[model samples]
Target: MPDQAERLRELVRHWELRRKQTRRTIAVASGKGGVGKTNLTVNLALALKEEGRSVTLLDADLGLANVDVVLGIPTTYTLAHVTRQEKNWQK
Candidate 1:
């Protein structure tokens, strides 16, 4: 591998170590639509994935969900369909 590739791998390894050592949950919110909120969520999830962290994107819009649309995951089930304990947002 080239020098830059080795450096990137080293950084990824470092991030993986950090991810393993610390687990944190963060909620991203926005008050306006078409304001890049979904984009931010998508990018954040991608970043965490790059860092080897487990990330789940939840639409939480009850009957409507667009995260799957932004991320392009077909909705198999919605919050409306999920019962009390059927699926606790474990995407």
Candidate 2:
């Protein structure tokens, strides 16, 4: 059996390959706003980025965006821009 670390590395590699080929985007949502969903998402994103994935987090919660808050990130853009068609979904 493979060691745990090796298995994780292989998993992440496979994930990154798929992410790159598919150019995937995912959302995390919940009816309960304060349930730490954003925190978990941001942590996973940062972990992937730290492991060398080029990641972008979109706070798609309309009026209640929170990924930036949990990740301590400040952005110059928002879903408002997208709603207004001011920007396409690119980084």
In order, candidate lDDTs are 0.76, 0.81
Candidate 2 ranges with C-alpha deviation above 4 Å: 1-22
Evaluated against the true structure, the overall lDDT of model 2 is 0.81
- As a whole number from 0 to 100, the lDDT of residue 53 in candidate 1 is 78
- Span of 10 residues, lowest total lDDT, candidate 1: 56-65
lDDT minimum window of 10 residues, candidate 2: 66-75
Q: Give a tens-digit lDDT track for model 1, residues 20-62.
A: 9886777876666677777788899999899777777666656
**lDDT per residue, candidate 2, 9-48, as tens digits?**
9999999788777766777778887888878888889898
Best by TM-score: 2
In terms of TM-score, how similar is model 2 to the real structure? 0.66
- The most accurate candidate by lDDT is 2
lDDT (Cα) of model 1: 0.76
For model 1, give the RMSD to the true fold.
Answer: 7.0
